[model samples]
Target: MTFNLLLSLSIALTLVAAAPGPGVIMTVTRTLQFGLTAGLLVVAGIVAMDLVVLMATLAGLNLLTLANQPGLLTLLMVIASLVLIVLGIQSWRRPIILRLDEGHASVSHFMAGIAVSLTNPVLFYLAFLPVFIDLDALTLHDQIVLLALISGVLTLVLGAYALLAAKLKTWLFEQHPERQLWLNRISATVLFILAITLIHSTIS
Candidate 1:
């Protein structure tokens, strides 16, 4: 949990949060339908689940660290790097279309947010975390700070998305497909860079 690691995670998470996805689309669609508060609820739900996923990942990472098997850890890191690279390529090749499904009337917007998060999940962010977080050196204070970073960054970034979903819905998603394409590329670029950085760190 070095400052550089936190900073890199913050920047990378910001970009990932801002990228187009089911979560973003839900925020936009719900905001357009129910209003800003509704959108924030959605963000809240997503953030809640994100923290859950992070905690679970941290638990598994702790077990890996405690095993004291550097070779196994290194192998996993290599695998994770390859996965990130493949994800980058797939995202770069994918196209985004703006279509809003009429959400279930019985489900609350907050619940819908949780469902979207669960459905698409945080595999991308999960891959990004172990690359930067050194479990061997992680103190309790560092763990607290790390959790704070994840929650705070997500809240600020996704909250901003919810705040702007109304304005951006038409201009960004609906009208200019190119703009969305660039966003997708940005996410892809981040993924590729993370993969390379992880490989370098593991070997070095």
Candidate 2:
């Protein structure tokens, strides 16, 4: 990848990653509930999903193809919506209890993060957009390098956000747990709305 190409990809990835979506909400909630370690694990899962989506898009399974397979896309989106709704409701009901003694690090928590990340369609869409935009111009070696660079940038951006959320957990919970609940609810509502919009768009 040329410098210009890399710079463009980095800028695009940064903007996409910075956008507040289901992944962001999940990372924040996991960080608050389980700590930074868990949030990072979720970040890993998200990155993995991005890789899969990007690869698929590069292989010509573009958004248009997905749109054409409305039955599959609709099913996936509905499943994802249900997962987001359940997660949001659970986060609202349960207060985050920090276990300082045991330390907040576990494979299970990391896996949970991955599961949450995999369930969100918005992440797939974001990953697909960049692949659609950049894949055709690069040679095979450059494509591999570009994919690695993009993935690395995304991982770093997401990890930073997860770490920031973990760092802010104390202040966030202390100030108002109810506020976090409200935020989770709002995030969940947005997720559902997006899911509906995607379905409608696909069908139309």
Candidate 3:
């Protein structure tokens, strides 16, 4: 990718990833509950979902196609909204904790992250893959380069969040065990709002 293209992509991706959304909330929750290691695993899951969405979009299974389909987009929005609501309610009802005896930290955290990340369609439409589509003028090699840079920057930015979460985990656990629940509610709220907005946009 050209430097300018790479620079633009980096800036855009940073802003998108840095935004307070479901992924960010998940990372923070994981960090507070488990630690940096678990949070990083969540980040990996989010990135993996991004790659999947990108590939799907590139292969013609895009949001636009769903939007064009009569009820598909609306259904997706409804399902996503419901998932967020359930997650929010669940978070509100439970204390977020790290069960050290449950299983291997890495596997458990990664699996949870992957599951949570896959539930949000907005991540694909709002975040990473859009950058690739938007920069379609670039050659394949340049596109790959740009994607790599974007992913690398995202990893760093997200990893930093995980580290911060790990550092603050003790404080969060001690002072406010309910902090994770609050974060979950906030994340769910955002997701719910996005779902409604998406449905409205699709129908209009």
lDDT (Cα, tens digit) per residue for candidate 1, span 45-120: 7778677666766665553342244775466556656756765686588676456332233235566566456444
- The segments of candidate 3 whose C-alpha lies over 4 angstroms from its true place after superposition are 59-62, 70-90, 93-136, 175-204
- Backbone clashes counted, model 3: 0
TM-scores for the candidates = 0.57, 0.71, 0.65
lDDT of each: 0.65, 0.63, 0.63
- TM-score: which candidate is best? 2
Q: Write the per-residue lDDT of candidate 3 for residues 22-123, one digit (tens) a residue.
A: 678778875665567778888887787666566555445666666567774457545545554555455455556544222136665565455455555533
Evaluated at residue 45, the lDDT of candidate 1 is 75
Q: State how far residue 167 of model 2 sits from its true place (Å).
A: 1.2
List model 2 lDDT by residue over 1-204, tens digit each: 668767876788788788887567767666766677778877887787667666766666656566566566556555654554555455556553433322456665454444455445533554555563555665778768767976798788878888888778767766566565665555456545544554454455
C-alpha RMSD by candidate, in order: 10.1, 4.2, 4.8
Candidate 1's C-alpha runs over 4 A off are 61-107, 167-204
**Cα RMSD of predicted structure 3:** 4.8
The global Cα lDDT (0 to 1) of model 3 is 0.63
Model 1 clashing residue pairs (backbone): none
